[model samples]
Target: MKLLFLLFLVINGAHAATHSLKYFYTATSGIPNFPEFVTVGLVDGLPISYYDSKIRRETPRQDWMAETEGPEYWDQQTQVSIGSEQTFKANIDIGKQRFNQSGGVHTVQWMYGCEWDEETGATDGYDQDGYDGEDFISLDLKNLRYIAPVQQAVITKHKWDQNRAQLENRKHYLTQECIDWLKKYVDYGKSTLKRTVLPSVSLLQKSPSSPVTCHATGFYPRSVMVFWRRDGDQVYEDVEHGEVLHNEDGTFQNSVHLTVKPEDLDSGRYECVVQLSGVQEDFVTKLERSVVKTNHGNTGRTNPGAEGSGSSGLIIGAVVAVLLLVAIVCGVVIWKKKKNAKKGFAPANTSDDGSNSSNNTAPKA
Candidate 1:
C-alpha cells in the first residue's frame, strides 16, 4: 500500500502548474501541394486535434482525445472547422482587397487561446489575427475592443469592435466555454499530462575557438530554463539562447551557447544549469574539457556535417512549434511562378479557390 501510494505520487504528482489551450487557424493562397486552410488545436503545447481542407474532417491527434471523444464530438468539431474555413477564406480575400492587391501569394492566420493558472485559479485569454506575418488585429478583452496594428486593419477593428454581440460572444467563448473545455481536456489526459520527464543534458563543442553549447533534450511540459553560470553566478554576457524546439517524440529540446576565451574554457569556472518547471532539482553540467563532447581533431577543426547533424532545426508537421509559427508560415512562400506582383509579394499561377461557395457559412452571431 505504501509503495502503491508513492507510485501514484510519481505518476500524478507533478502536473503543469499553468496550462494553456490554443487554436491556430491558417489560410494560405498560391501554395502547391499544401492544405489551403488548416486548423490545429493545442493543449499545453501538445497537439490535440488537427483539420485541413483536404481532409475536411477533424481528427484527434492525441491518444487521450481519441479515446475520450466520440464520433459526434469529432463531427461537431469538423463542422466548426468547416465554418471557420469559410470565414478565414473570406477574411483573407477581404484582407487582400484592403491591401489593394489583385492576385499574389498571401496568408492569414488566427491564434486564439485561453490560459489557466492552476495554483492561483486565474484564467486569461487572447485572440489575435495576423496577415503576411504581421499583426493585423487583436482583441483587448479588458476594454472589449479590437486593436489594429496597421492602418489596413483599422476598418476591421472598428467593425468588430462595434458589434457588441460579437464581442460578448467572443469573450464568453474564450473565458467561459474555452476554460470549461480546457479543464475537461486536462482531466481526460491527466495521466500523460501530469507526468514529468527530466532532460538529458550535454555539452558540445565544434572546435577550440568555437562557443560551447549546452544542449538539453527529451524534456516534458515545454517550460524549461537553461543558462550558464560562472563560478556559481549566472553569466549573461556572450551567451545566446536558442528557441525551444519540439522533438519527434513530443518531448522538447533547447540549447544555450557561451563564448569564452580558450584559457577561460580551460579554467573550469563555467557550468550549465537546467531548470524544468514542476521539478525541484536542477540539472547541472560542469564545463570541463574532458567532459565536453567535441568533434575536434588533430588540426583543431571539426567536421561541419557531423557537428550540424546534432543541432535542432525547424520541425515541420501538424504539431506546430509555438516559437516557429511565424517562420513556418512565412518561410514556405517559395515562388512557383513570378508575375508583376508587389515587391514583397510572390506571384501566383494557380486559382485561390479552396472551398465551394454554397458550403460557405456566415460568421457566428
Candidate 2:
C-alpha cells in the first residue's frame, strides 16, 4: 500500500506540472508592404505551458471574426511553450499586411491557455475573461494611418487666400490708374478753354427810321451784352436786349435791335462790345449813318445860238490841230531832201580865182 501511494503522488505531480498556464507576447513593425518580427517577454512565477499568438489587419466592424478570413489575418495556436518565467519570449512572423490601403489600423495580439478542472478533463474555459496567462500578458500594435485629405484642405485654403490678396492689389492699382487719367483729362480741358478764339464782329444792317434797328451775333459762350450810350452816358430804360440763342455744341449767339431817329443816327457813335470768360479779350465796333440830302425847285433860261456857236468852235479847233500836225511832218521831210541835194551836187571852182576851182582841177589836170 505504501509503494502504491508514492507512485500515485508522482503521477499527480506530473499532471499538475503539465496543467500550469502558458503565456507569450510579441511586437512587429506593421508597415503595409514590409513587416518585421519582434519578441517580448512576460515575467511570471507560474510555470507556463501553452501559448497562442496572432497578427492581422484590423477591420471596420467588430463582428469581422465570424466572416470569411482575409489574406492577412491573425494565426492562433494553444499547444506550444514559447519561453520560461524569468525570460519568456515570442517571435511572430506576420506576412505582408497592407495597413494604408486597408483604410484602418493594424494590430497584433497574444493569447495563452492552461488545463482547467482536470478532474472533469474539460478543454474549454481555460483562460480568464481579460487575462492571457498567469500574469496577463498583452500587446497593442498599430500602423500609420493616412490623413491626406485634411492636409489638402489646409493647402487649398492658403492658396485661396493668396489669390484673393493678389486680386485686391490689382484692383487698387487699376483704380489709381483711372484717377490719374481723369486728372489729365481735366487739365487738358482747362488749357483748351484758355486758348479758345473769339468770334468776328461785323455790321449787318442800319435803319434811318424813328427806331434805328441794328442786328449782330457772336460765337463765344458769354459774349452777348447789348447796351446803348448817348454822348458817353449809358441808356438802359428805353432800350431792350433780346435773348441769346445756343447752338447744338453749346456755343452762344445773340442779336441786338435798337431804335433811334435819323437825328440820333447822326449824333454820336454807337458801340457794340463782346467779352470772353477764360481769356481777357474784348471786341468793340462803332457805327454811325450819314445825313440825307434834299433838293428844291429852280427856273431855267434858254440860249440856243450860244450853245450852237460853242459846239461849232470846238469842231473847228479840232480840225486846225490836225492840219498843223501834218504841216510839221511835211516841213521835216523837205528839209531832209534839201540837205541830201546839197551833198549830191558838185561845186564850180576856178583855178586862180575862187569860182570854179573843183571843175578846173578835175578836168584840165
Candidate 3:
C-alpha cells in the first residue's frame, strides 16, 4: 500500500509538471484552421534566462493517467494555468526590450482569443466575462530608424529645397544692384559730356592778307554741324570740312576752319552755329568786319593816314630805344669812374728800389 501511495504521488507530480506555452502573434492566431501545430514556451524575466526557453517538449506529459483518474482529475491537474494577462505582460516586456536595443519608441497591443457559438454561428472575441480566442499582438511604431535607401533620398530632397530658396533670394538681390549701377553709369556719362560743350573761337592769322582764317572749336561733335553763312546765306561750297577728335571720356572735340575774302569779311556777317543732341540748346557766334578802318584797312591796303599813324608809333619806339641806350651808357660811365677812384685811393708800395738807391749813395759818401 505504501508503494501504491508513492506511485500515486509520482503520477500527481508528473501531471502537475506539464506546461503550456502562450505565444505572441502580430495579427492572427490558430494557424487559420490549417491544423498547422504551434507550440508555445515561456522564458524567465531574469537577465540570465531572458532568451532561454524554460518550458519545452521534453517536460512530463499531462494526460498519462487521464482514462483511469477520470475527466475531473484531468481537468483539475492536467490543464496548464497560463493567464491572458500574464501573456500580455510578457509580450509587452519583450517589446520594450526590443525598443531599448534599437533606440526607438513603439506602442504595443494584444488581441485576445475569439469564440464562436455553434447555435448562433456568431464569432465573439470579447464578452462581459473575458476573451476566448487565441491572442494576436500588434505594434505601432514611432521614431523608427529606416534601413532603406528611400529614407536617405527623402532627407536629401528636403535639404535641396531649402538651398534652392536661398539661391533665388540671392539672385534677386544681385539683379537689383546691377540695375542701379547701370543707371548711375549712364547719368555720370551725360554729366561729363555736358561740361565739354563750351564753344571756343580763335583767329589763326590776320597780318599779311585781308582774308583771315578763323577757326572754331566745339565739343559734342556728333550733335554739331558746321557751315559758313555769308550775309545770312549759307555758302556750302566755300566751307572747309572740320576734323573731329574723340576724347578718353567718351566726348568729342571738333574744329572748323573758314577762309573769308577781304571784301566779304568787311561787308557781311558770318555765324557759326553749334547744336546739341537731345537738348534744344544752340550756340551762335557772329563775326562782322568794322566799316571804320583800324590802323590797317579792310582791303589789305595801308591808308596814308594810317601809315602816318604807324610812323608816329615807330618814332615812339625809337624814343624808348634811345632812352634804354642812354641808361646803359650812363651805367658804364659810372662804373668806370668808380674804378678810377678806387685806383687813385689805393696805397703805393715804396720799399726795395728806394732803399737800394739810398744805401749805394751812403756807401759812396
Local distance difference test, each candidate: 0.68, 0.28, 0.29
What's the CA RMSD for each of the models? 11.0, 70.1, 62.3
Measured with C-alpha atoms, the lDDT of residue 42 in candidate 3 is 17
TM-score each candidate: 0.79, 0.25, 0.25
What clash count does candidate 2 reach? Answer: 11
Q: Residue-wise lDDT of candidate 1 within 163-243, one digit each (tens)?
A: 676567677767777787888888888887777778777678788889988887777877788888999988777887775
Candidate of highest TM-score: 1
- Candidate 2: tens digits of C-alpha lDDT, residues 101-126: 33232323233222322245333211
Compare the candidates by lDDT and give the number of the best one: 1
Runs with alpha carbons beyond 4 Å of true place in candidate 2: 1-194, 210-218, 247-251, 278-281, 290-365
lDDT of 2 at 100: 23
Q: Write the per-residue lDDT of candidate 3 for residues 81-136, one digit (tens) a residue.
A: 11222333343344445335432322222211222222343322210100112111
lDDT, residue 341, candidate 2:
6
- Tell me how far the alpha carbon of residue 6 in candidate 3 is from the true structure, in angstroms, after superposition: 99
Q: Tell me which residue pairs clash in candidate 3.
A: 21-40, 113-133, 113-134, 114-133
Off by over 4 Å in 3: 1-190, 193-196, 206-214, 218-222, 246-252, 278-281, 289-365
What's the CA error at residue 299 for candidate 3, in Å? 19
Rank the models by TM-score, top first: 1, 3, 2
| Residue 33 local lDDT, model 3 | 32
